[model samples]
Target: MHLNHSPNQNIILEHSSIHLAIKREDLIHPFISGNKFRKLKYNIQQAQSDNAFRLLTFGGAFSNHIAAVAYAGKEHGFKTIGVIRGEEIGFKPELNPTLLFAKSCGMQFKFVTREIYRTKTESNFMDSLKTEFGDFFLIPEGGTNDLAVKGCEEILEESDLIYDYMCCAVGTGGTISGLINASKAHQKILGFPALKGDFLQEDIRKFANQDNWELVTDYNFGGYGKIKPELVTFMNSFKDRHKIPLDPIYTGKMMFGIFDLIEKGFFPKDSKILAIHTGGLQGVSGVNDLLKRKNQPLINL
Candidate 1:
């Protein structure tokens, strides 16, 4: 266990015993902690390799990936742009949490409608953005690109594979897809889909160029970022038991699905599974606030 705890109760549980041979030093940047570094590493390199002076990507208001890209791009001294999913309203200087942070950190943002935002890979849009930004590298939404796949593929190489299966919450599916492709061990890539699913497995193969992955969409708790009372209690007990801290959006639902599938006899009793702690612990802080507002109670399973 190698994690620094804050004075507040926000705990990040890490396993030092799961050491690897090909460890990358830049995996632990100040805000680029956890899978963010792995997920963004090759994307940044690709931007530079393509003679791109600017890097443009897409995300929602409070996306960690967007934040990371902004910070990392600025750190690497590349001009960064964020294609925000929703329209910006009012004459507000400070927008949402992510918008404010991205702008403050020197990442320029362009707001777009949901319909236009959907056509992210269309040639017309790409050409227009290229013209606007002046020769920029295009990273997909959530930084889920081939380069990001290659980068996250390195995460599997960095992990010790003593388990029969690998599980992680899938937002873009790039993370699990990359790991599935990079893995040599005969392990199942159990992915908990964070979206309404939206054919993420197809998107995975499109982005990752691989088919060796499974999508567990049963435990999304209705939709992305939505949480139920059972989920909160389950998260608490999981912390009490394995001491595994989880976000309601990603890892929490992942663990919920994993345990439910286990109870349903999805895996053999002897199967040794290693759940990938693809960190989104910061997301849980906001979840706590939500639970408090809704007067959600904490009870055990």
Candidate 2:
């Protein structure tokens, strides 16, 4: 799909003498959008090549991966099984938009306790799932694997070489690893992790061939799925100003870091920047619910 590489006209960029453009990967597809689409592209092909009838993956109550894989599996004629993180969600799927959407797409769920879900990468867990669900293609939590990284490398095109910096939100590190591999020699890739940690650097290094990348670890609000009122306010104001909706889990935090860096003079003057908007807009409804319960300001969707 041909996506628009639109310039962001935020006044902050003007004041900082930085030129920023957003690669609208979010608009790639309504259901299978952004990095999820990239990450799943080759994995889906591989699953078909292996003659798999089912695609089994992992996720939490409000996971974007769960929703994407479910839709992708349904659209491509493969049955999907979501190994959901919380056992409670299995009985109350209707309460969460992400899970509800996946269920609507014909995904079966195997909700596990947080403890069992922690053993998801172990051989014993794999054996148990195999005994229960039969032969299936396994996509790891967040769908990060060799094939997924290979698919993500296609995210940056020749036209993107003009940019000096490539920026994106980091989740399981798959997207940034692909960006790091595909990045131009002169371009420095900066990742704003949505979760707190230095562990992602090592994970990203496993797939990344180039060393032109660094992770900005300060923007993760608290941790995964954790958000603050300031972040909510920024997201709403940013959408009102830029006409772009950013999900709090990833892109919103990345953009917040980018704008903060620009304001703090982190980038050299006259630098050209391209931010990859990896879509997770589907999780916004779920996030708003949490905000409502807390009596905090909700993100203006």
Candidate 3:
């Protein structure tokens, strides 16, 4: 259960007057990195306190949550089950790096269709899972829960109060919600949603207690898990310049947004900004595999 401090590294820009720093939450751990670590920390403890040994969760094919839960459960001596979307992957798990890694970590998989995966939170679906897995601890998809939010609230430290704007990639909204709740009154939290839609405003409002936040919707790059060649180019160039790697799904999009916003003069002069690097680097390999198959430019590892 050892955790490391996430350092805030300053990003030097030659032209832009906006001061930017990124919280290296990605460096928190190998498998349980970034917001995954924060989201799971308290959930695991609650499961242990409840004396629930087996842990069951949900995710897509290249899900960081599934990988983190698999490794964390193995590390904590809990049996893990991943109810994955896309039943086709169940028949050929060896082809997917994320699934193979989870399997190597001793996670059992139950594959279902996208339609079935949507009902994952329903009582009937959960009762069926309980019947099959026998009283396992259930963690919601993307690991967004009250306890998870509590853990994510620990991401910001006292030193973070110096920043005027805090930025983070929004998935299920837990990470930004925690930031919003933990941030100072003067600090504004900006969320870059991975998925398309205004639904996140409602979702984020469910957990976020503060009103000092805005969603930058322009950089989703054609929805979740979808990317353009320009984005791949930017990510590679960003890594080459800053010595920081950005995952395609979450952090990459947020970083791209931040840089673009800077170029557009969105931030006022001398406005201190902090962007959270919520890790999903493990999925880069899987994404590269997809890109290779699609004959598109791949993200450099």
Task: Give the candidate number with the greatest lDDT.
Answer: 3
Number of clashing pairs, model 2?
0
TM of each candidate vs. truth: 0.80, 0.96, 0.99
Candidate 2 yields a Cα-based lDDT of 0.90
Candidate 3, superposed: residue stretches over 4 Å from native: none
Q: Put the candidates in lDDT order, highest first.
A: 3, 2, 1
TM-score of 2: 0.96
- The CA lDDT of each predicted structure is 0.69, 0.90, 0.94
> Please, what's the RMSD in Å of model 1?
6.0
- In terms of TM-score, the best-performing candidate is 3
Candidate 3, residues 1-301: lDDT per residue as tens digits? 6788789999999977889999999998988989999999999999999998899999999999999999999999999999999988888999999999999999999999989999988899989998888989889899999999999999999999999999999999999999999998999999999989999999889999989999999999999998999999999999999999999999999999999999999999999999999999999999999999999999999
By lDDT, the better pick of 1 and 3 is 3
Instruction: Indicate whether candidate 2 or candidate 3 has the larger TM-score.
Output: 3
Where does model 1 exceed 4 Å of error? 1-27, 88-95, 207-212, 240-243, 286-301
